[model samples]
Target: MTTGRDILRVTLRRNAGAISAGTLLLGLYQAAETAFPIALGLIAEHTLRERELGSLALSIGALAVIITTVSLSWRFGMRILQQASVTEAHRWRVRVAACGLQPVAGDTDLKSGEILTIATEDADQGADIIEVVPLLISSMVAVLVAAVALGLADVRLGLLVIVGTVAILSILSVLSRRIGTSTREQQARVARAGAKVADLITGLRPLHGFGGNHAGFLSYRRVSTEARTQAVTVATANGVYAGIAQGLNAVLATVVTLSAGWLAFEGRITIGELVMAVGLAQFIMEPLKLFSEMPKYVMTARASADRMALVLSAPPVMAEGRGRPSPGDDLEVEGIVFGGLRELKFRVPAGEFVAVAAYQPGAAADLAAVLAVRVPPEAYAGVVRVGGRELSDLPVAAVRERLLVNPYDGEIFAGTLRSNLDPGGTGRPVAEAVEASMLTDVVALHPEGLDHGVRDRGANLSGGQRQRLSLARALAADADVLVLHDPTTAVDAVTEQLIARNVALLRRHRTTLVLTSSPALLDAADRVLVLDGGAITAEGTHRDLLATDETYRLAVSR
Candidate 1:
């Protein structure tokens, strides 16, 4: 759904059956409860005024029946309502998770940690509307029943109860707006704090290397403090709202009770009627209290639903396409203008090994993001083609099957070493890939070899090992058009040379593009293109460029 109202609206529609059943049952319970005091007033009147034994016994029996109805209806009604609510919450959690994993990146301002909170706490709160609606209805049923009973005794008593309830609820609704604001702010601030904590943990290794751990912690502390302050504000607002609602409800009860006694004193009402009016007035306060509190619950639920809406309503990253790339794998780009690139163009013919050295920072990153489909098509100006067909015109699945882009910092999930390398469980022999990426050493050292356990993000592995593992995973995919972005940056000179030569051999007869300035990888490429000044300035073999171009030599030497 696109908005908080939509989420609530749809949830209600989806669980209408449960809500209806629960409301019916709870209404029966409330009717039974309202009758209890009225029944008592009747029993007291008959036993005192008439002194008829049969009448007293019959009144007592009716009271027993009312109590039993109250117990059974309440037990079954709440069970159904709560179960449906839990199930709805689970569905929302899954929906949020799926949105995050979708290929099209949505246009949303929420961070990963914020989404996490939405999927958990916000989802649960949003589903609370399921319970809130029914209970609110049930509370109204009780109030209406009490009003009717009190009116039978005295007209003023019933009118007083009705008007008092409306006034109390109206005042609460206005006051709850402040509570809503505070709740929204509190949730947002808490989500921000969570996001910062997640970032710090993800980059803890680098923070220690650069001695920025203290700085990171300090930044997180600021966010956490803000969250705490917002929480306190929400608590204070709720406190004030509840206190005022309770006071108003008590005042209404007192006024009704006094009015009933005054009527009896004037000899305008019978003794039985007086007892019933006083009992009904006191009992009405319970429903009134519950009804007044609903505004606060609804406000909190709406705020959560709105927080969830931010992610659900974002625009997709890519548009749908019906076309597909043609036969053969050829990498081509023409007149692309994006992020530090101006009219830049290049082509890697099918079955050719090509390397590009972009002298400017973020140039390779931009190219990789575009080629890998990490960027939305509308985000930049470019024509990137594969197999003589435009990437934008082709379907997302077709493009993915035709091309693969291996980034510098690939994610390494927690699993067995083999599972990390071949996440899809293709069962394709990854021995060649392992050897080519120089990851065989890590496997052999653990004795478990490919079955060795891998910590999340390869935390147990050294930097170079993680890099090789990433390369090995990419090589195992064996896509037709593979783009490697600085594939061997972390290894030593000798290991880098081996990986470079092995990648060239392993990827023979397939289109390969290496975006790197590393001399070892450049030397292994059949051809090298030098990117400078937003365009290709020179093209030749690595040695040919090194011997002839001073700028190329200086860049590669570093």
Candidate 2:
């Protein structure tokens, strides 16, 4: 459960200046609006008694005008607050993205989708308090204004109304505590369900292949049902709190009316005073409801705040170490080791084709990650040097700019073929890259060509097509060095041969690292590095390794 102080802190931290001013203006307008009804009741009593023509009519008209002005002001103030809250949400989302993009050292575990959910969903919730809190405070002011009007009518009636209002408010406050707990639990359940659904959908193919559809779907259904149940719990609690508050207000209204009538009968107050007290009841009831409703809103807002905090608090995946490396274009990995790879050293000339075959594919994948600067060199015990400079010693952005690594599982985002092939091209020509990646055949087969629309993650494209499109994207990047992991794994042998040949031709003079067990790709490489047990056990041509290295032979064996 979140406290009032926590919700206030989040609102102020996000948009303090705008929210504070909006709240003050709203409170002032509500105070005036609350007084309008009482002023109308007094005017009515004076008109009936004295039958005044000019003065009474003018006063009543002026009060009506004031009520109109207050209504307009409240509307405009609400607009300003809503706009400010939305702006705060937008700014918070940008901050979340900035934090997520901080060096990988501190952000590895943060999922992109999770950050998106936090920024939009959680931030919106946190901002909701900006609109709700001021109205809640104004409601209390309305209740006070009613108390003052009722007091002028009859002291006993005023005391009864104030005490009853306080009691109703107290009940509301108690119920609000329960609201916060339920809201927090509900939000957690929803987030968990969202993450699970996303994971299940993304890995649907693998799950189906493993024949775990029934079990996986059943588990997902269970999680979904749990989330629904929590939502129902929250809704039930909110409804009960509202019902009780409304019921108490009705009871208070009856008690106040009966008390006012008793006072009038005893010759303690006038009939006009009885009418005034009845009129004040309506004013007090609405604000009472508003005040009561606020706690539930505040509770929801706090739950959202906590969710946003989770995203903000996530650490980046990588850290920038001290010192800067000299800028250059060569690629080198000294004492590189991770996963199955032990302490190994290797360097690629500024423009060369190097193929690596590892007995354990995980070792090759880890080494590729280290070489591409995706995984920190420190995670293993090594130095990955680019352009004769250690990668860790250079800014991450600069390293990323000079190098491109396209893993086999790279996503093909929903977009036209042109957008998928050349995302950052900004309408630049992608024909060369498409042709070089042998995607000319793919385009020729499609009537839409580069304009063909791909579904999310290329659900519309075949596995091999997705891989080829990924390769085309990398080719279009025109990076200095490109590392590809099992790029042709999903393609047929004939297609693989064509892609392998095209990849080598396209990257003729560029520094390219291909992690593969394919003989065709290895045969095209200028040199082959055989990874066995852990370290690079042999370095030679593809033919040489096949003849001399038992581990490489076994790994490359069909």
Candidate 3:
């Protein structure tokens, strides 16, 4: 597990060369800027003392060199630093995205909106640390070099510059801490607001149909208002900090100028030295301001990095199995006790069509999850076997390739119908799956047929259409064992009947498990298991169970 500090260290190490070059160039630029006023003062003194044209030309030439160096170094240094910052952001974004995609144990309690914020906004903030270090080093180098040059010219003036800079930074550091706290609160509020909006948008159609749109709107508005208030508070703090920084800088510069003027008036320092003191005093303001803001950047970057580390360091939910699954179609659940399943035992032979009618909704979902490998084996006390081999001992990839559990509410990505149906480009003939899933009517409605555009999460399609499309995609996988949970609930009775018959015929020689309460699907299966009270109480053909078991009859009737 990596901490925030470890992440920062790794990032710095990765970009060490770029950081060093940028820091060196920036420091040289600051040095050259400081030299300008000193050169002017020296030229003035030389003119008054020697009155030599040759010496004047040489000083002017040196001033030009300093000006050129300042411009060139500043331009190149900023380019390098900015590019490095962008690259760092890109790296963090990719890492966070990949981590989010992996299956991890336990609940992360992170919504899609929060994950989006971390990958985008928080990633940029984490990358800002790249610039903060180099800028701090360069600013300190400038301040130190300026102070030394001033002291070399006149001891009193140099002492004033160093003492004033220290006082200003001390005050600003306290204020920056406050800013950091406020920024964290602001970011959290914004994330919550974004999450609320995303949820509302995803369920907009349902909310509107149920006449809950107005209530949902009020909820979103409340969260949005809170985020707005936090943002305002953050902005106010930043404004106050900026004002204080600028005002203090101006006051210090004024004091330094006045002191230099008094020394020149008293003939304690030459005219050139007095000019250099005033110039150095004014020039130090930018570096002082940069130094004051470094603490705030550092704090923000630490917070963002910590958020990123939360995702990156999450442990996997289950240890991966090293063994591959053996070739077989039989699936056996022995003495299974997890969630709503209590000492459940069942077996489906090779090339058999089995249906499980679970009365409890939670049991149905939990059973589906167990079959899909969504839950860790450690969470349950059971032995699930395929081809006489334990599922826990088989590699996840091999199990997934052989057995596919299509949940009732599967996801539909944004793309063409054809792409969604055949994402792997397996070239397994989309027409057969579409026909078996009874989606031919949907494909025929659009001129583009399989190429018809689908919105995000199949928003553009009807609920029934989306369900059929999801079934079609699962069928296209051509897995040896297919488990479907209520695959025809969204469609009408006629469509459901057609889909059930078509699926039975299409997968006649394959092992299939259907967990549903629908009569059409249950009647189509070769065997039906009545699951109740965490156990299978009865098992037989669908018609036999319906006639002999009252509980099973009532469950399928609804």
lDDT (C-alpha, whole model) for all candidates:
0.89, 0.77, 0.88
Q: Where's the lowest-lDDT run of ten residues in candidate 2?
A: 101-110
Candidate of highest TM-score = 3
lDDT of 1 by residue, 122-218 (tens): 9999999998988899999999888888888887887888898889988999999989989999999999999888777667777999999999999
Global local distance difference test of model 1: 0.89
Q: What lDDT tens digits, residue by residue, belong to model 2 across residues 441-494?
A: 889988998988888777767667888888888888878888888888877887
* Residue-wise C-alpha lDDT for candidate 3, range 173-205, written one tens digit per residue: 899888888888887789888889878766777
Query: How high a TM-score does candidate 3 get?
Result: 0.91
Report clashes for each candidate as comma-separated counts.
0, 15, 1
Please state every model's RMSD to the true fold in angstroms: 3.2, 3.1, 2.7
- Candidate 2 deviant stretches above 4 angstroms: 1-14, 98-113, 156-162, 208-210, 321-325, 371-378, 425-429, 445-447
**Which wins on lDDT, candidate 1 or candidate 3?**
1
lDDT of 3 at 23: 94
Model 1 stretches astray by more than 4 angstroms: 49-64, 102-107, 264-275, 412-472, 490-495
> In terms of lDDT, which candidate is strongest?
1
Clashing residue pairs in candidate 3 are: 105-317
